[model samples]
Target: MDPASHPEQLSVVNEQVLNSADRSVTAAVCLRRFLCYGSESSTYSTKECPLGIENALSLMQLIEGGRGSEVVDEVRRFNLEGRAVRPNPGLFTLAVCSQHADCKTRQAALRALKELCRSPVQLFTFVQYKKELKEGSGMWGRALRRVVTDWYNGQDGISLAQAVTKCKHRAGWSHQDLLRLSHMKPANDNIALVCKYITKGWKGVEEAYAEKDKSEDLQKVFAYLEAVEKAKHSTDEQELIHLIEEQRLGKEQLLTNHLKSKEVWKALLKEMPVAVLLKHLGKLTANKVLIPGSPDIAAVCGRIQDETVLKKAKTQPFNILAASENYKRGHGKRSKLKWEPDRDLVQALDCAFCKSISTVEATGKRFLVAVDISSSLSSLCRGSSISTVAVAAAVCMIIAQTEPNAQIVVFSEGNLLPCTVSSDMTLMQVAGLLIQTPGGSTDCSLPITWASENEKTVDVFIILTNNQTNGRENPADTLKMYRQKSSVFSKLIVCGLIANNLSIADPEDCGMLDICGFDSQAVDVIHNFALDIF
Candidate 1:
């Protein structure tokens, strides 16, 4: 039998060797939990026993001595979770592979490395770690060689060169293994030239071209490089004019392709004519390239008076949420600029809800927005800079602006209190109030129970949470109880702020709806349910 197939055998062997030591028992339990938790038979029926990245890392660290296969099994479980449901676990995987000597463990580590390096930011991080490896170290050298070999064979030359460049500039170390691997794949001329320039100099490029008898094309390549250099140095006005001319040449291709530098983008926004800039602002906001609190952002906001522009800007909140989440995952970094809410952007988020409401006739339905301020929500919402509570607050603001009859409440640990949400409240004020509220254990049922006790009637109840409720009462059960006591039939909409396979909504109930994350379409989903049009 495969050693990996029987974790119990490994545990028994470990217990005997450790002579029933406390550490050994702990290690065995962690390993058993990891294996069972990742198995298909495990349903995660209880919230307390969920398998997470921390559990996988703890298990790998606890095991000791010649149990290479068992360690590999745990690492395999981690790899599967990261690929399927969990957020990025690259750092933990890297830590394990760096410390362990097992060949199987190293192989699993290589696979995780490949997955992690798919993001440019993560690739930069790996390159920094690679720089610290001692010259000719057996473990890391072998692993780094395998990574480069895979990149070469897979024909991912651009990514390979990008990794090498970022490593050299940021880490301040020359990667000889990557240089050698580049020569192994000489058919990729672009990668070859980039490697040659970095490892040697322009002289290396001449020699490389002479050897391949392609010296005639060298001038064109040099000209392109010179153009890029010039573009980098050009003033904002000159860059804007050049971009406009280029757009004419390419029949209005995305402006993002030309303005690659963040500084240049900011400069163009400040200096470009309002009419000229408005044409491209829609795509810029959609791509989320605009930096928050930049002067250019304010300028763009001031000039966006067109209804079409406002409609396009309506999706900015969703884009910001996505970008912020990516930043938290180590895939990107946040700007140093202080985050101040732009009035125009806030209006745009409100417009998104208005647009969704306009799709159906205005029913003047009353909305009750309940935000979960439980202690669990204080954690970063999937590596994002914003907390789960902050997102919940933003959603409440949207409802307040769209529905005149909307009321807001904050709940935690079976306690519910009215929030001071009003149409005149600024976005920053709303966020501050919600984030400052004290939190305890999660009680998703508190809001519904509170509403039922107060004899309140609302057409829709919107609950924002991560859905890891540890309340004395389940939300669905509470909703059922509320319906029995109250004559009004209110729809319960749970907006999950985290991505997970588990759902709180009953599949058989049409009145209960579950939506995940800060998706742009969430406004429409809530609106459709309110209208009973779904």
Candidate 2:
């Protein structure tokens, strides 16, 4: 394979090799992006959207190659331990991986079924995916039966009641349908009664309660289920409020019309989790419960300010950013609902994002943060109102604020635009400035070329972009040229702002990394990568 011996043939062979390597890198990047953010569509948003799951699964299989089992194991552990935001992607990936991986990995992946299927909807999705692959009613294997049985019987009576009540049906499969298919005999009287409710509704559960000699635990479960049934049918707000307070029912158990009641919202605010509160701030405001000087607003702000609650909920910074942006806009992203956003509530959301950032010690290395402001990045991120350019700006600011010795520059095709990023500049201010900056075609190599020409001694160069580079000089080769000129072994991190498969980092270089743009742990990850801590 010593191509140098034949100079004429070496040119073609080298080009072919480069093309093959680029294809492999693109596949790997696509697989990673699909796992993190579902779908191969270019719509990159900050919301937890579950779009094109089946399509994403097919793409993963085509690109996964030999690493299917490893990726599945990692995703399973992360989702099972509640480290990931939305568990549906992980669950779907595990199902797909089990079908394609080796026998042992298949067993290991399937063992996580009960833990991963926390809700009835998730269980239905999982079952649907598994069944779709094999077209037969007789495809229910022993392992499938065991897992389904364990999923129903493993939860405590109260948790099971909440699960059945909150999600009656999903993915064209009902709890009754699943119960019938599994033929699962209940392990306890309480579980048995919940199953009865799932199969025959409140009538069946009440019938059992009237006839059976049940335990106090079963009686309590019966009471909770009865409250859920009443809450579903009741039009009286006061009675609904009483039931919510007494039984600790979530907003899901209530009827849709009752959600408009300000008193009901006030009651729900008392115990709403930080995640749910952020998601529904618009609805709360539209109902006038979050008006100025309202106690409901105070309660919500207090919860948002609680760092403990934020951490426990594992709320991502992007979620807060999207909430603030959408709330300030005073309209739903995909709904007709409109409201006047409360100034105090918006401030609290912004502050919550700042406080929620994970603190990490700076590596004290010289850094160059290059952000791409191309026109392609102007699209609104998939599930949020914020633009991809703004998301990039917010992420860049996070890094610039953390590291003391960092300089930022904006780049397009032939320009290295002026960047006024400062430690004191608010994220929104920086975003507005960057978005206003005139953009041209994307050129990812501008950072490296600029650093070399300016004689900047940078230990790390971070490029935030949509990965659509059109420069003549390859960024990888430019990095090598920069290393030769400055005699500094600079590392490159390509943080993709949108869900594109292209990457600028060299796959062969150990000093380069390709990561998602708005990863909640972006700052810590970048710092560690710079310090060689990974």
Candidate 3:
């Protein structure tokens, strides 16, 4: 029987053979099957393709079982003959570094890595792995040093220096490795300069080279280094002064640049003059730019000293939905910045939403904030480490704060559980509480059904979800029924945290609005819809 034709049957057969026959023979058969069918399976684009890095890991596991010496020899031959490596270089690097790999396997893995390092991108990976996995290990370090030396010898000095710098800064190369490479025979003056700048303090470059002989080459290098230092200091001081001056002038460009900086934008926000701060607070709030390191935005909101600014802040068409989508796509991960908006700032932002409601005073309206805490919501938002649930919680907190009569509910499957949200609770705290709530199949109708069954009169139903709704009853049908029975005009706003084509709103219903993401503008949308003003 051909095992290659049926992988499932092969798995079962392999499992039975392992239990009934010699372990080494069973392993060898498994290895051969993996090499043939496994390699082909890895090329398949389908999600069900079983052969992957895990398969390579499993093969290594078998080799480590003390009976697969032949398999080890086969792998070494694969490396020696330039045959297709079972796993790609990145996965192979991770696999071979495991403690489970025998000495023979490690040697073969290193050889394969050496070949892979011929590509500049792969060389960067080698440097990263050296720092992450095998730091200070003599064997791995020597291997990498040799590969780098060979690469440097073949490449132009300037290109090689740029590649080294890129690897050092972006790939997390250690100073020690960079220093060693700087001293290699093929190393150019540019490479040495970059290495020195990274490894030594900028101010102490002269001190580091104080003892070197006063050759013409050395003198020229010293002059260039000093000039570079002067230029950097001059640029920094000028930029700082220019930014301060721009803030004083109440220039919009300063706010634009600040927002574009992402996490570091907080620095600009904090340092801006008070006049600039007050002038741009509305723009900042409307854009939903979370000012880092300061609660100034909140302070401005609490003071409400300028009613016009408050009005603008409340009504600005800020897209929280887009921001939430960007967060999910992992935009904030590289910045390593946590989303820790000040409590007052959060309250103030929520208040802006509250103020947007024209029919009733924000403090007097009855709000039902339903957040989907389904299992999928726990996953990180794009470009951000912050979970989708966390963003939803923040939105919920904002909606709840507008009215003292607000009720927050977390729904999953057919369950609707009330959430205890205090005004003092941080977004993180709200998120933590929501995460603790039990999750099941998504039922967007649960919250609506609960409110209708209990005779609850909700002015607005704010549902925060990824729109992957699977429920016994359609949410749109349930919402329609609730609106018909209610004496008060109710609005349904679906805030999608995930970017998908599917929407839960009825296209024909004017009362039902679909907003993508947890944007601050959602409150305005809700407020406008409730009053029939839009």
RMSD of each: 13.2, 7.8, 18.5
lDDT at position 467, candidate 2: 61
lDDT for each residue of candidate 2 in 1-534, tens digit (9 for 90 to 100): 354664432332222223422223233334434444453332223445554446574446542555555555446544543334445666777666566546755675677665566778888888777776565545467667777788999989999998988888887888888888888889998899899888888897777687878788988898899899888889888998999899988898887788879999888777787878898999888878888997778878988978888888877666788778888889997899999988889889888877665433457888898878766668665334677776777766766776777888887778886576876667777877677555677788899998888889999998877666788888877887887788777888777666434466665554676664454444444654577432
List, residue by residue over 254-348, the lDDT tens digit for candidate 1. Answer: 24445654444554554454335533443455345565676656655554433454444443343444433333233223333233344465454
TM-score versus the correct structure, for each prediction: 0.44, 0.78, 0.40
lDDT of 3: 0.51
**Candidate 2 ranges with C-alpha deviation above 4 Å:** 1-72, 80-89, 96-103, 211-213, 359-367, 373-379, 402-406, 412-424, 432-441, 453-461, 465-467, 479-534
Winner by lDDT: 2
Full ranking by TM-score: 2, 1, 3
Clashes of each: 1, 3, 15
What C-alpha root-mean-square deviation, in Å, does candidate 2 show against the real structure?
7.8
Q: List runs of model 3 lying over 4 Å from the truth.
A: 1-364, 380-386
Residue 45 of model 1, lDDT score = 22
Report clash pairs, candidate 2: 44-382, 45-381, 45-382
Model 3 agreement with the true structure over 1-534: per-residue lDDT tens digits: 365875533443344232211112233333433442232111211122333446554465655664333444444333343332233333333334432346664554455455544545555545555544443554344555665566555554344433443343435545445446644554665445545655575655566666766557545545544433443344343553444343221222233343443333444554444334533443454345645344655455554433454455433312322332333343243444444334555454444433433222353567888988776677654323446786677666666665677899887886778998876776567878777555677788888899999999987787877655788887778887787788555667776665433467664444565554433333444554455322
